[model samples]
Structures are given as C-alpha cells and as structure tokens.
Target: MRTFVAGQEAVDETEFVELALGIDVDLFRGPLEKETAEERRARRDVAREVLRELRESAEAGDEVAGWDALYADALMRTVPFVRAARGQRAGTGVAA
Candidate 1:
C-alpha cells in the first residue's frame, strides 16, 4: 500500500499515513452483526448517500469534484480505497 502511495510526488506522506491510521474500520464493515434495527437505520444518513455519489463520480472519471467531496469530510476521507485516487485533486487538504 505504501509503495502505491509513494508513486505520488505531490503529497505529504505523513498525512496519508495519519488518515489511514485514523480511519474507523467500522466504516468499511457495513452493518455490524449485533446492531439493533434502529442503529442500522440510523447509519443510513445523508452523508453516506453523498459519499455514494462521490464514489460513483470517482469511478466515472469525474475526479476533481469527487475527490473534493470525499476528501472534504473526516467521515468519508479516511476510507482506504480513497487513497488509490487521493491525488486526483489537491482536494480540500483539510482534515475534518
């Protein structure tokens, strides 16, 4: 993973490492096995919907705006897969 990230020359590597480490694993885990029905519904938020659109845009080669939205918030920004296209734009460069 580091090697892939090292291919980019524009980033401050430490920040990526930090964000990677800071990412909440649950975000990638989807619904937990023990989650109550209400808890599951609560996780279905506008933010997740917005993130979904950004993910689609990224997949579609719409890079700039997509990266900005994904990288704009702490919640979505730390997603591991996002690093694959992190430098697609300078992004917000702000950690939530």
Candidate 2:
C-alpha cells in the first residue's frame, strides 16, 4: 500500500508501516460470493418485463409525447443487482 500525505504534514516511518500493514490485512480478505442463480433469474425477468412494456408502449405510440416513460426503466430493473455487485467488488476488491 502507498501512503499519501499533504506536503505540510509528515508521517513517521512507524505510522506509514502501520498503514501499509492495515492495507495488507484488508487486501488478503476473502472475495465476495457471486449472486445466486435465483437472484440472477429474477433480475433478468424484471428487465425482460420492463423491455416488453417499453416495446408495447412504443408500438402503441404512447411514448411519442416526449415522455421519458421508459427512461432508466432497464437500469432501474437491474439497480439492485448492480448495487450488490458494486458493493461486493468494492469490499472484496474483486470483480463480480
């Protein structure tokens, strides 16, 4: 681990060593578990449903009124999983 301090502030060697040791301890922690199959399926289903609704609305011209009707719909559907994955990645320092 690298320690960075403002130019005006100086850290002693012992403090720097402690900081590096802490970082090393954290780095060796186990990776996070992947999402379960059920969770993946559920999220996919939600995204599919949202896409279907968007398609229907577009077909019916309901989306023609400058409506952001489907705005972020797909993203919203996957937000939970995305957030979980992000948390896992950040915590474990591993890609999900």
Q: lDDT of model 1 at residue 94?
A: 52
lDDT of 2 by residue, 52-90 (tens): 665677778865311322443433433344446566433
Q: What's the lDDT for candidate 1?
A: 0.48
Tens digits of lDDT, candidate 1, 1-96: 333334543245655653544323344333233444466456546457656776787788887646544554554334344443544222334531
Cα RMSD for predicted model 2: 17.1
Task: Give RMSD to native, each candidate.
Answer: 14.9, 17.1
List the pairs of residues colliding in candidate 1.
none
State the RMSD for candidate 1: 14.9
TM-score of 1: 0.30
Question: In candidate 1, what residue range of length 10 has the lowest lDDT sum?
Answer: 87-96
Best by TM-score: 2
Q: What is the clash count for each candidate, in the order shown?
A: 0, 0
TM-scores across all candidates?
0.30, 0.34
